[model samples]
Target: MSGSGSIITVLDMFGARLPGDLAFSLSQCGSISADHPLAGEIAAALGGKAASLPYPRRQDFMWVTLAPTAEQLRCVIEDLRCWVLPSFGWESSPPIVSDGGPAGRMGALLLAQSPQGYFRWHSRPADTDHVIARLATMRAVIAQAPARLSQLRPTLEMLRRQFTLGLATGDRDMALQAIDEIDQRQLDTASNALSMSIRVAAAFGDDQAIVDHPQLDNLLSMRVPQRVIESVLLAHHAVFLADLEAAGDIKAALAAYLPLHDRLSGLAGHPADDADTGIVRMAAYDAALAEDARRLHLLADRFAGDTVVAALVASPPPIAPLPILEPAGQPAPETEAQSVEPAFGEPLQPSVAELETVRVAPVAVTAEPALPLGWSDVPALVATSAREPLAALLQHAALMPDACDPGDGDFLIELLTDSEIIADTKKRAQADQVLTTVIDAYVCEERFPRRERLGLYETVLDIWSSSRALSTDPIDGQLLLTMADALLRLNGHLEAAVATMITRWWEARPVRSRLAWLGEALELLTEQSSAQDYLGLWYAGAGLINVDHEGFSVADRYLWYRLGRRLGLDGTATDEALGVDWLPLHSADDPLLAAGFRKIAIVSLHERAAREAAAQIEDRTQAHVVLVTDHAAGEGTASAATADVILFVWGAAKHAVYRAFDKVRDRLEYVQGTGSASIVRALERRVRAAGG
Candidate 1:
């Protein structure tokens, strides 16, 4: 074959008629002679003389070259044995080679052509060991190559399918699986495609994309590192958590599978790995839920919402029983002042360690000194204290049947002066007032109807004992001795029993430090069938101090309110118990409201006062009366901004309630105190000024 550029130029003349059939014997020679058998025909094919045949080289057999013609030139090797030579008719036999045609050096190449194709097999001189080793190595590689390729085919196919599914549907799991498979199979192209899809999903915040999906959080536990996608997934996780937080799915947001913020922060500023970040995430989620549950429980406990039973169960009343007080020289542990007095006094009381050591002992009874009239010696009363004899003197003085009993009134004064224990000046004065009221109740029949004898005794005794036992102020302790004496005179036997107990509690330690003694006292009073009105008043007082005051953190306001309700106080009595004096003033409408007031705001520190004022204002006028207190911060602001007239209470108001009236000073047309006249006069003055 001959070619030009990439094209083949074939000239077929093998079957064409020649000048003649020539036969020749082949030999390895450098010359072709005219005497050669085929020389004439070759010369004729070339259209030249016989001398034109060229001798190119000596071959193993023969090599021939035709001289260049005007048209074409060529070279060829002829196997004279295989060449068809003109021969006589019948002899057909295999020729035996004498020298195997022309043996040459072993370096000589043997080129062979066959119908199949050209083949070249090379062999170089080597030692026997070298050849054998080279063949063995080749054999090993050839044996394993096919198996390795076959093993990876299924894996590559799976990766391709995963990649296809990831692209078609925004399925992050499929995409991640595909990426994982590609990594395992070393399929670089498929991994790149899946990674690109992740990038798109992350960019758009696609819900099902590998980077944005919640399942991406699982990467924290994955063993194989996902270096390229990890950072993107972390960022997307942060965004998702923030969204949940903004939507107020607090639990779900905290439940996020990764510490995404910490992870991203680590990436930017530190170098925390997934394992550390996962531990932090778990800790944060647990802490968040714990804190939330704690706050909710605290709020519930404090507010008492619908959780009355729960509150009672969680904090049982009276805490533990009061430890029994021993006699003198065998003192019990010191009690925290917070334990005996109401919670409102907790901040004011001395700490347990700071309180003075006081011991409880029964009063010494010597032979009674010359007894006064109607004050015969009683052993228990005398043994209690020398002052107990004087209390008996006052009790008789109060009940003496004289229209103007100077003896009874003077008798109370003697008791106050005779007792060395009546030390606090204010407490002594309060006791004097209480004794005078009781004695005067009998002396003047007019004041007798107004006398709250038992109430007066309880209130004064409570104040005096509180001053002596719980006072943080610079006050004398002797006042409690005076109070116990006064309680004995007022209630007689009942007062004596309670006074003894009070003296014991004063010297003993309380088991439940946060509970007030009043809770226990109320139980005793109730069981003893004491007056309901007195019990109601006690409940109201304790309730207010324990909840509404600055010292306590627990909620006892509603609890006491409910307990007081059980006492069945009438409207007037309930008002008295709550320390409000608006009933007499509430009988008629305020004159100002009758003078065409459109809206009247009654602002009080207490809820009951506000409620009472609202009722009175409604009764008197067509104006709408809004009750404003500290609890009604919203209502206060609303009414103060819009009301036509404000009845500013300057009496018994807490600072909190006063602070709520900042916007309503201009419309304040009336000012009232704790009395009925102050309220009525203020309203009347406003009416007169308005020409009503």
Candidate 2:
């Protein structure tokens, strides 16, 4: 009871909102037994409680956080003495300072318990040149193998956090020094692949650092870790070496790097392990490097330029004089820039004097200028095409109908299959991109058009489905989506389109959301109601195990928009909503929606519950309740008598509507009543009767 005030102060230090998880973790602790009722509840809430931090999470608190059970007051103190403080020299200097700031005061007010949450009010930055010097000192102790080496792993991890801090502070020299210390002191085998890769990339601009230290060679050449890491490292080094050769001292650079390249090239046939799954090979990079020595030779093959040779043959050498040749009776020496007087008022120019004396004849050299290489040249020599052009070709595919030759799509597929492009996971993804571009081109409307574009789709799909029996890449699936979209517009099998694309992929929930968004995008792009709306709904709903109520709303919006003015949504209604539509639904192109007729009836299908739910609509709409699936005088169907709604029940299969079209009405009826059936039925009858 006497210490209640002190405990109260400790609790107060935690406050309403903990500054960080470490602070919070340290707070929900103290004197509460593990078997207590609150223990399970508290720990469960703490799991991933870092996610519930205020809005944006600070990265600093991710590591070095303190998590203590509520049972012990000094559990944190024991932890402080063992892990946090000893390395930090907490006996003399703690890891943190308080200074009575908001955090400091709050911490003090809560942790009124001394020692465990103690901190100095203020402090200054480190005076050491190497932030890692402390780590370098500790590495010696850990390497001694004094039974404390197991503790070495976590301590070194703390060193990694410090390295990240160095990165954040933009301290390159400190970062480099720290890495050098790790390689030199702690790691006897090889540096971690992820850490080493980051260092190599970071050293891109720092040639002096790379050349002065061959630590990269050690990092890359290390024997064992993960094969994926090894393959990735090899590729990364190959790219870096190629870049440096282009921009730096080619001779010196290649001499230092050729050995590495040869070693990596020798590893080309290394068995496909887990890491090799995503790799895509770049044969062009290999081919380009093969020409490096030849290119160097070509650049240096400056064998006496045309200007030098022409000067040698036509003019005398600078020091060697050309004596005047006496032409029988005349001397031929009027070649100095001296003033020569012609008996005129002005001094004669050098050109005038030279023309008067020299009798040189004109020479006509018969030579034609070279014509530049056009499309034929590039297509012929397609050995090493630039990646930039490929990007452009894919981006503006509309312009590139002949991007590949007539049978070249097949050639590309074969090339992908045969090459080491899938040598690793990274490159495997690239292969997918290459394949997707080809598919996107063939499926595009403006590029291929409808004349035979569907044939292209069949060809590509055949090639894909037949090859290696691999699953279609997600991007390639988009090709099917586009085709489905087109088939719907062409009045082809929209339901089949939906079913085929959705069959394998609809199981993922997020994929369903994407489909839903796409459907909404399509509906908002419509002119009037068509059966295509069903495809859109099916497409959006295709990828979900469980769908949201949003699908119903999408269907409702489309139905209302399709019905238009009768539903009070088209004509002036649309104009009030959208400023202008380029192809207005009420235009000469489409007059169906323009005239909302009262006649015309077709069978509308919905569940029995739906009819009962629209019961209030019965007062306003003249609809006869037809039990579901009751078309053509069947037991479940309603009689086609009186002006009432011919409700046709469409079950889960949206395509059943089209399949059951024959039973909808033997001939169209002038459905003189409310709802979609009346207008639809009347229009069909009008079209059939006016068949002139």
For all candidates in order, the CA lDDT equals: 0.36, 0.33
Error of 2 at 429 (Å): 4.8
Q: What is the lDDT of residue 452 in candidate 1?
A: 36
Q: Could you give me the TM-score of model 2 versus the true structure?
A: 0.22
* Model 1 residue 299 CA deviation in Å: 25
Q: Per-residue lDDT tens digits of candidate 1, residues 470-568?
A: 532211222232233334434556654554445444344332232233432442333334455346336445434422232221112222333455466
- Record all residue pairs in model 1 with backbone atoms less than 3 Å apart, i.e. clashing: 363-384, 589-620
Error of 2 at 477 (Å): 6.9
- The RMSD (Cα, Å) of candidate 1 is 48.8
Q: lDDT of candidate 1?
A: 0.36
Estimate, for each residue in 1-692, the C-alpha lDDT of model 2 and write its tens digit: 11445544443333233343223333455433454322322332234110011111232111122122221223434543553344543332453323233365545543333312333211112311121233233333444645634444433433443343333222334445656667767642354533343443332222233333445555434432232233343344444443443354333433444444443432222122211211212111221233322111211122123222122223222232212122233354355612332221122233444333322110111111222432222222223444455444443332232333324344445435544554545344444545544543344211222534454444454444334223333333333333443444344444444444444333333353344333322332232234443443443343231212222332233333333333334456533332232112323322233233332223433232233223422322333333333323332332333223333312111221222233343332322222333233334334445451
Task: Please give the clash total of every predicted structure, in order.
Answer: 2, 28
